[model samples]
Target: MTEPRWLDTEEMAAWNAFVEASNLVARRVEQQLREQAGLSHPQYEILVRLAAEPDGEMRMTELAQRVVTSKSGLTYQVTQLEKAGLVRRRNCDTDDRGVIAGLTDAGREKLREAAPGHVELVRANLIDVLSRDQLRVIAAGLGAVTRALRERP
Candidate 1:
């Protein structure tokens, strides 16, 4: 059998950078959201995704996809939001077995309150440190990675 191809120096550096930067950014975002908005990063993402819809609503499955979360994880987060009175869920109008999540006025207000600090923290930690060209390159590269992964099971 042939030996596995290992990462070379530059590839190894790139991999390390990706892993470290992603973790740092995620942690900072989580911290900022919690401090300023009493929300977790995943919870903030759920609110943002639902807020983007015209009706401030989306199917729970679609939301799980959009947030890159598992079905059970999404359900748990939604339950927390529901308890907080920021979100509501009901049977999907078109599919009895499906669920839909809707953002309440409280959710929108929470998002509005949280967004500024979130954006500032993101920019400070990642975006502002990177040049525009760097941002474009990283976006393209990560977009490809996500697309490839999503295409698989």
Candidate 2:
């Protein structure tokens, strides 16, 4: 049997730091969203993506892909948002089997209200902590990783 390679000390330190930072950042963002907007981080992400669309609308499948959630998970979130009057589901015009989720005016307002605090939290936790060059390098490295993952079968 081939022996598994383990991370060296320096690599282990980097990996641990990455995991810790990621967890902390996610928790902070989630807390801020829940406290200030009564929204979970995932829901906030959905709102942000829909708001960016030309008509504040997107297919459920597309949204699932963008948010990196399963179709069932997106459906649940969308259903919750719908009950809160933040979003509505519509039949896709060209495909009877497709579902589209569109942000309501209330949803847009909620997003507008939540945006400032969210941006501030992100800056406080992440952006402001890094130099411009460091940010650029991190972005490039993460972007490469994201692309690779998405391209995998």
Candidate 3:
């Protein structure tokens, strides 16, 4: 096997900082969502995605893809949301084997209640920490990485 090239000091520092910041931000957001909204980060994301859809619904598999979650994970989250009367699962009209998840009115209400705290947490922990140019650079860098990963076989 070929010897692996290790990260240099600058690269190592950058990677470590990125990982640390990402973890801290996620934890803070999760805490705020759980405490104020009784929702997990993933649950909050699911609600947001559904809210953005034209019909406020999406196929389960599509939702999983958009959320970067496993099919089973999405199913479990949907089940939990259904239990809370925040979401419902329906049979897909055109596909017998497919299921769609639709956001309920209760879900929209919860999202509306949760959004302010969530946005504040995000701004305080992340967006407000960076300058506009830094934010742009960070977004471009992360987007490039995302595209590269998605393009990989």
Candidate 4:
């Protein structure tokens, strides 16, 4: 068996820094969303995806995919949002077996209100910290990684 190579000093430093920064960014964004909008990060993501859809509606399964959440998890979150008058669930008109989640007018208003804070948080924690050149480098590097990973066999 061949032994796996380990990261050298410089590589280790880069990897550690990237991991720490990624975690911090996520935490900061989550905190900002909760503090400014009374919404969790995952909940905000769900609302954002729903808002982007035509008629602000999508099937439960589609919502799960868009938000990268499990079906059950999405259902639970949707239920909570519904209770808040932010979203509602209904049977799909064309398919009896399918359920659809729809964003409410209140949801749109909440998103509109929350967007400024979210944008500022992102800019303050991540975007503003990067130069244009650094942004281009990061975008190209991460885009390549995602493209490679998303390619099918």
Candidate 5:
């Protein structure tokens, strides 16, 4: 087997910082969303994704891809949203086998309710702590990581 290349001191520190910061930010977002709008992060993300679309709808598989979730996982979240009257799923007109998820008016309202606190918390915990250049670099780096992962078989 090939020998593995380990991270150097600085590289290790950067990796640790990235992991810790991500966890902390996620925890804060989870708490804020749960308290403010009764949402988990994934569910909140689902809503946000749907809201961004022109018709506020997307195929379940596409949503799963966009949300970085499995189809079953997205199905569960969408089910919960449906129970909460926050989302609706329907047969896709273009694809007989595809299901589309759409945000309801209540989902829009919930998102509006949750967004301000979420933005403020994120700003307090992450965004406001970073310079614009830092944010850009981080975004580009993470975007690259995501693209790499997605492109992998």
Candidate 6:
């Protein structure tokens, strides 16, 4: 086989740190949302997406795509949210087979209540940890990485 390509020492350290930090950040954010808002990350994302849509709603498949979740996963999450009175499901008038997910008043209230503490957790756990220059570099780098990943086959 041809010589294997591997990360150099510094690159390897950065990669490991990025992975660990991402996991820790996600866990902490999820905990905060679940405790304060009765919402998981996926649920919160769905609600947020619906609330931000033109009619405060989106087609279920579109929502799944926006949230980067599978159809079954989004359906499960939406069902749970529906149980909590945070969202409602409706059949699309334009297409009988298409479903629409809408944010309820309770969902908006939950998002409003959750946003403050969620932002605080983000600041405390990640944003506040970086210096101004570091923050800029991180933002740009992360955007590039996200774009690359999304573009990948």
Runs of candidate 4 exceeding 4 Å displacement = none
Tens-place lDDT digits, model 1, residues 1-153? 999899999999999999999999999898889998999999999999999999999999999999999999999999999999999999987898999999999999999999999999998999999999999999999999999999999
Task: Give the poorly placed runs of model 6, Cα more than 4 Å off.
Answer: 1-3
Ranking by TM-score: 3, 1, 5, 2, 6, 4
After TM-score superposition, the amount by which residue 66's alpha carbon in candidate 6 deviates from its true location, in angstroms, is 1.9
**lDDT accuracy of residue 3 in candidate 5:** 89
Candidate 2, residues 3-102, lDDT tens digits: the string is 8899999989979988999999999999999999999999999999999999999999999999999999999999999999999999999999999999
- Whole-model alpha-carbon lDDT for candidate 6: 0.92
Measured on C-alpha atoms, candidate 2 has an lDDT of 0.97
Enumerate clash totals for all models, in the order shown: 0, 0, 0, 0, 0, 0
CA lDDT of every candidate: 0.95, 0.97, 0.96, 0.91, 0.96, 0.92
Model 3 stretches astray by more than 4 angstroms: none
Candidate 3 lDDT, 1-153, residue by residue in tens: 998999999999999999999999999999989999999999999999999999899999999989989999999998999999999999999999999999999999999999999999999889999999999999999999989987897
User: Which has the better lDDT: candidate 1, or candidate 6?
Assistant: 1
Candidate 2 vs candidate 6: the lDDT winner is 2
Candidate that scores best on lDDT:
2
| lDDT score at residue 117, model 3, on the 0-100 scale | 94
Worst 10 residues of 6 by lDDT: 47-56
What range of 10 consecutive residues in model 3 has the weakest lDDT sum?
A: 144-153
Q: Estimate, for each residue in 125-153, the C-alpha lDDT of model 5 and write its tens digit.
A: 99999999999999999999999999999
